[model samples]
Target: MELEVKPRIYVVRLGGDNPKLSTALKLVRLGYAVRIHAKEIPPHSVVLNPFSREILKPSDSALLRRYGVVVLDTSWNSGLEDLRSMVGRRRYEQRVLPVLKAGNPINYGVLTKLSSVEAVAAALYITGFKRYSLEILSKFKWGLTFYELNKEYLERYSSTKSAEELIKVQNEILRSMGLQP
Candidate 1:
């Protein structure tokens, strides 16, 4: 009898590399299917990642087709240079601003990404507003914590545990900018 072996395949998610990839893999390695992404694409059908096109694959395109294409572009081949172009006249002012102030891109150098969004929100709240530590929100399962929704934050926005919840979170984020908790 003859035997054949196939090389194991791994998918390195698009966008920025995820540090927790290994940790996540460890939890469900056997008899499990996993999806990992480097950056988060907004609610869109198509994404254009001019930078690091290598990350895009046939499967990526297929997966993206599910959404309505909230994000038209994914990354810049020269990401930093692209960022530089985006800043332009504001270049000097940008350096002085913190990562959070720079805007909410899923891939912001070492800044917080979608995986870290929930805890980052907590950190932002703790450090910038309540002047406390974010020991609580850190334990949340998602990028945003459902229990921590303060009255003020929920006032302008609504809440839910389903897909619709994303809208509320997005709304709260707009108002939460620079204000902290």
Candidate 2:
């Protein structure tokens, strides 16, 4: 039987703040991901950018399978300057995750404040890699909670074929929650 090849997961740890609590660092330790500098991100890989205008879709799975995925691990306290520097002119494809509540201890229940691992897992899940996504999240104590909290949204988002569809689903979810979309 031919061995299956998994997409590479890369995390760029900015400023190295609170390494102990870093889910991205934990993933690296568990041998599920790699630590790399911002400049080292492979060309055409999907870079998780919260500031990105483009929303991630199931179609992007092809890019993830071929060029892999990247997440920038940084402190919320770290100013946008750090993030802007990395995302400003990068060759990588930048895509943002839809609004989802955090499940990590630090920012639990807060919208769009997922931990690094949560962000990576969300990307994988959105791109049709549910098994790998759960496997990565299983490594964290509060990992599964992230999935539980966002399962409805994840399921809906993953089924979307395009960014527009994903946005429409996100809006519907938000409207149902009585929040302005």
Candidate 3:
């Protein structure tokens, strides 16, 4: 909604029947420029990590516009382990998404821990592709619900001009939720 940058999207799937994978499939079906990799991904792509301390914000949009976006698809319970085992072997600009409420069945209304689709959508939203994000979510029944639940936080992160400002806002929200930031 902010800019017209259309960078390619890539998903490194680790064999999961999860919503994240479902969303990735939907993204591919929707004619979005998406590449699915079951093995190692390209080193130049900007990767998303649930364990990273670097909260993604509006400032990262330019980088994504230039290098594209990458999401690692794995099971929620084994996310860190899977990412570490798989991603640790590669070099990527890893970043975490800002705080958002989950709308998925397993973790609905929960903070920060988003499903694969939600994480990708959040990144897309913060990086000036709000419409595209919504479009991706539209493929599923709960997609709009996820967007509505985290709309405020998504907008705030998307509006931030710098990573520091985004981090400050993210910290405030997390603190209010009694979450360890």
Candidate 4:
């Protein structure tokens, strides 16, 4: 009998604004994620970066399983600056999630404005951890709704075998929504 090794999930908390509404802290409390400092981020791990040029795809599952995934928790106001500071220095594999609507009350229906947990779940789902993704999202009342809002996109993104294919699907989706790809 072998115990299944759960892939590590890490959150780098740089934004202390509105701690009460922070989804990243909630994840730590629920034991679904671990809180670590920016400097502690593992090398070659997948770091969710909104400004990243690389798109996360199913092909990254093996890497994720071996190196783990990370989500940078920062306020929208300081997000870009926070990301910029960490982008080039760390040997992290930064990835950007394709367009997806937010399910959190604060940013509901807004595209690509996901909470920390939502971003983590999206990365998990895209990396072939669908069941684990749903598990984490189930902890929050609006978490599952995130999946509901972007089910079609999530499904299509997860089905892609490579980043190029994933980008193609995402472009088509954007075009269909009348948004420039």
TM-score for every candidate vs. truth? Answer: 0.23, 0.94, 0.85, 0.94
Looking at candidate 3, the ten consecutive residues that score lowest on lDDT are: 84-93
The model with the greater TM-score, 3 or 4, is 4
User: Tens digit of lDDT per residue, candidate 1, span 1-181?
Assistant: 1112111112223333343542223222431213334243223223222222122222222232233111111132323454333232321111111112212233322222222223223222312212111332333343223223332442222223332353445445655664342
lDDT of 3 by residue, 27-101 (tens): 666776465674455555668887675678776777788778887767777556777664444466778787789
The C-alpha local distance difference test score for the whole of candidate 2 amounts to: 0.87
- List the pairs of residues colliding in candidate 4: none
What pairs collide in candidate 3?
none
Error of 1 at 109 (Å): 14
lDDT (CA) per prediction? 0.27, 0.87, 0.76, 0.86
> Can you give the lDDT of residue 11 in candidate 4?
85
The segments of candidate 4 whose C-alpha lies over 4 angstroms from its true place after superposition are 1-5
lDDT of 4 by residue, 1-181 (tens): 1114457899898884687788988988888889999889899899999988788888888778899999999898766788776665558899889888899998999989889999999988877788888889999999999999999999999888788899999999989888998
Model 2 lDDT per residue over 1-181, tens place = 1113567999888864688888999999999999999889899999998888788998988899999999988887774567776555569999889989899999999999889999999998888888889889999989999999999999999998788989999999889888999
Model 2 CA deviation exceeding 4 Å by range: 1-5
What lDDT does candidate 3 reach at residue 151?
Answer: 85
